[model samples]
Target: MRLDKYLKVSRLIKRRTLAKQIADKGRIEVNDRTAKSATEVKVGDQITIHYGDRTVRIKVLALNLIAKKNEAQDLYQRLD
Candidate 1:
């Protein structure tokens, strides 16, 4: 799945547009390498997002194109 879509579907960023913007700005990484909005996200991949002074790291556990509010958290495992 696309990184931006994964973020939104997983409720990481709340919106696909915001996730795309952030990814395009080089603020997101996959497996420690810079990732683009269209980057492919696979199960078990680690995603690190830089949110200004704060950083969030998570491991992708599943990919769901449409997920319920409570199911969003099941898509990724927070690492930090």
Candidate 2:
């Protein structure tokens, strides 16, 4: 899954376009390296997002093309 899409599918970001904007701003990282909107992600990869004075880390648990509100949280495990 692409980083931006993953963020949206996982409900970490509300929309795909917003996720892309955030990724484009260098506010996101994968496995400790800066990640782009199109960055490929797979199970077990770590993702970090920095916004304002907050930082969130999540471990990829699963990938889904479409996730319902109840299922979104299952896509990633919060690390912090």
Each candidate's TM vs. the true structure? 0.98, 0.97
> How many pairs collide in each candidate, listed in order?
0, 0
Q: Across residues 1-80, which tens digit of lDDT does each residue of candidate 1 receive?
A: 99999999999998999999999999999999999999999999999999999999999999988999999999999998
Task: List the pairs of residues colliding in candidate 1.
Answer: none
Q: Write the per-residue lDDT of candidate 2 for residues 1-78, one digit (tens) a residue.
A: 899999998999998999999999999999999999999999999999998899999999999999999999999899
**Residue 50, model 2: Cα distance from true site in angstroms:** 0.6
TM-score of 2: 0.97
Lowest-lDDT window of 10 residues in candidate 2?
1-10
Residue 77 deviation, candidate 2, in Å? 0.6
- Candidate 1 stretches greater than 4 Å from native: none
